[model samples]
Target: MQYFIQRHPLNYDGSQLQSLFTYKNFGLMGDSVLVFRGSCTVEQNEMVDMEDVVAQDWIHSEDMLHFIVEHFDMDLEKTIVRQRLLIATIKEELEVRGVTTLRRSGDDLYAGDKKLSVSIATLSPVSTLVHCGLNISNHNTPIPTIGLTNLNIDDVFQFGESVAEHYCAEVLSMRLARCKVRGVS
Candidate 1:
């Protein structure tokens, strides 16, 4: 259960609909540009700049999926394929760690007679958001469930860093392969 924040850049036009930044290296998925905008203090004076500021803030997995579908005009079939692929990868990873009882249904993974559940969502084509929850019961009486949010930021950050590193390396390899195939040196 790790999460990474991805920023997407938008350019404002006369209309409310903004344009997304695309990169050639991203292949069919396209790329998102990370832009950081904040107020800067100069001489003890804080000033706010007035710009179109076409940007989407840090969003959760579900929100990120919707944002991609809407902004990138992704078809439903492609979305479902991506979602299934991501869930399958997560299921395989969990199974490798001795969690063989896990069952995947749609975007959720359940284990131990519903005692544990992990909901997987895609933040983007390359990134996944996994939220784990544990069910607690007292003599057949169910109690409030505990979730991954209880974990500290340091733990989450460490996990996310590892995942990001792996993902970036895989993406870079794929891009390089494509470049070589295209005879682009």
Candidate 2:
């Protein structure tokens, strides 16, 4: 059996997106049989109480381990256990930064000493690939040559111009801003 997932990627903002997206088989393409889901499904780590058992992260479940074990044939019980333990710590870090990481399939959040019932949408590995393919086709050009770190001041301006022209209807103000700095960061 092969597994592929498709979901829309979260935008920079917290708004829900209308466009559908996908990722390709969760990076498992070859019939040669690469990693199958790799013991990294969101459900394994987070606990969900759907009914709001308490006001905090005190929700209850028998355990998601079986669900995970059922999903993967590799029998990675140890990996899942370790990852589940680390999830709380990672959630704390995300809370400190005020960034809530979410996936499309699960419902639960760890934020600032609270376990809240939350649902977020995220792209599957397949949706990500589809987005890249569409971007390539629309541009009708080779992939970008220079990484962000390699960009110079002129390159930055040019890149902004290209983005503005393609995405924005008006670039006169943006073009003016590009030539001058407005204020301190």
lDDT of each: 0.31, 0.24
Model 2 misses residue 45 by how many Å?
21
Pick the lDDT winner: 1
Q: Provide the TM-score for each candidate, comma-separated.
A: 0.35, 0.21
For model 1 the TM-score comes to 0.35
lDDT of each residue in 1-185, candidate 2, tens digit only: 22232222322111111112112324433211111111112231242323433433321221111111011223334324323322333234333444444221222332233332222222322221101100101111121221221111123223323322322222234447877987677
In candidate 1, which residue ranges exceed 4 Å CA deviation? 1-73, 115-154, 161-185
When superposed on Cα atoms, how far off is each prediction in RMSD?
14.1, 21.0
lDDT per residue (tens digit) for residues 1-185 in model 1:
11233333222111111223222222223332221111111111111111212232111111111112111433545435544544455355445444466677775555544423222222333432222212211122132222222212123223333333443444457557877764445
